[model samples]
Target: MMKEEVLSVLVSNHFGVLTRVTNLFGRRGFNIKALSVGETENPAFSRITIITEGDEQTLNQIQKQLSKLEDVKKAVIIPDDLLISRELLLIKVSADAENRPQLDALISEYSAKIASQQSDCLTLELTAAPEVLNLFIEKMRSYGIMEMCRTGSAALALGTQTVYHDAK
Candidate 1:
């Protein structure tokens, strides 16, 4: 059955590598829900975390195709049972004198921070699991969110496992 999957890919940290990976998804007709790429511990390589939807067969094909790419070293699904993941959000909400304290208290309750503040609005910065961020968004809707930016989820296998380790 087709279902959501998170993939961790290790690739050469060079120009065109990101393009190549994204193209693979487009070529295969798979929709990418979210993608994040950054340099790994070794500057020579990069780690990409991708959230997509596919079945077992499609996922297998993705793994094989990614491994065949010149710049891709490995691609493996990060099972929720063995994964640790988070996304970052920066949100600006309307906060006047009457509601400022309430917003501040709500932010503190969630361990979020006020990145900046103005007479009419307050910007909050938070890093947490996607679900937590969603709940925050839902609660803040009543306060009138002025703007928001989110960094798509990035994930890693829990414990000592490395992204580059060969999956068997």
Candidate 2:
């Protein structure tokens, strides 16, 4: 059975590397649910956090293939329960003077903030674990979410272990 999986891949920050990795998944008919890539502490390398759903066998195959690639240093599944992860969401919701108080309450309850306000709508910015962010969006649905955008999760292993790469 396919289940949620998060892979932390350490790779050389070189051109066409991302395409190669994504092509591997495409060839196997796998869809990446979320992917976030950014520079690591060492500017020469980048960490790619990919979230997808696949069975153990498929995950193993992908990991093995990734490790064998030219610029890929290593690929390992970061256990969902054993990692620190965060996602960011920006949402613009319908609001007015009468609804401001209730919106304020939501902001307080979820530790979010009113990023901007317009004549009849307001925008909010929230960053948190997936579950908490989902809940906040659900609650805000009642007020009509006008626009929204979310970034793929950024995650790291829970302990001191870090994904290492060959930086030459």
Candidate 3:
């Protein structure tokens, strides 16, 4: 059965590294649902978070290919059973005097914070699992969403273990 996977890859922060990694996915015809890349706390490397959906064999192949890239220092596919994953979403919804109170109540019920407020719109920030975020988005659709942005899933393994290919 196909399942979603979140992978954390460490690579050299160099020109074309991002292109190379993305090209690998494109060449394999894998659909990337979301991707976030940023410099790590260490200056020498960068972290890339990729969310993709595929069966076990396809995911394994993608991991093997990613590991072969020269710029990649480590590529770890976080198994569903061992990972704690969450994403942050910022949503701007249309609101006026009529619906403001109802929207505020919905936001509170979802445990979302109002990041900004204007005369006609409200911006809410929510952090939760992807499924929860999707549900929240659906709920906001009735009120008319002006804009929305989501941070791709960021994940860490549970317990004391860390997935480091170099240490393996």
| TM-score for each candidate, following the candidate numbering | 0.93, 0.92, 0.92
Count of clashes, each model? 0, 0, 0
Stronger candidate by TM-score (2 vs 3): 3
Model 1 stretches with alpha carbons more than 4 Å out: none
* Candidate 3's TM-score: 0.92
Output the lDDT of residue 148, model 3. Answer: 99
Q: Which is the winner by lDDT between candidate 1 and candidate 2?
A: 1
Go through the candidates in order and give each one's C-alpha lDDT. 0.88, 0.86, 0.88
The CA lDDT at 126 in model 1 is: 95
Each model's Cα RMSD: 1.8, 2.0, 1.6
lDDT of 1 by residue, 1-168 (tens): 988888898999899999999999899887688888888888999988888888888888887888889888888888889978899999999999999888888999899998999899999999998889999998899999999998888898888878767722
Model 3 clashing-pair count: 0
Please provide, for model 3 over 1-168, each residue's C-alpha lDDT reduced to its tens digit, 9 standing for 90 to 100. Answer: 898889888889878999999999999998699998888777878888899889989999888899999999888988788888889999999999999888988888889999999998999999998889999999999999999999998777788766553632
Error of 1 at 81 (Å): 0.6
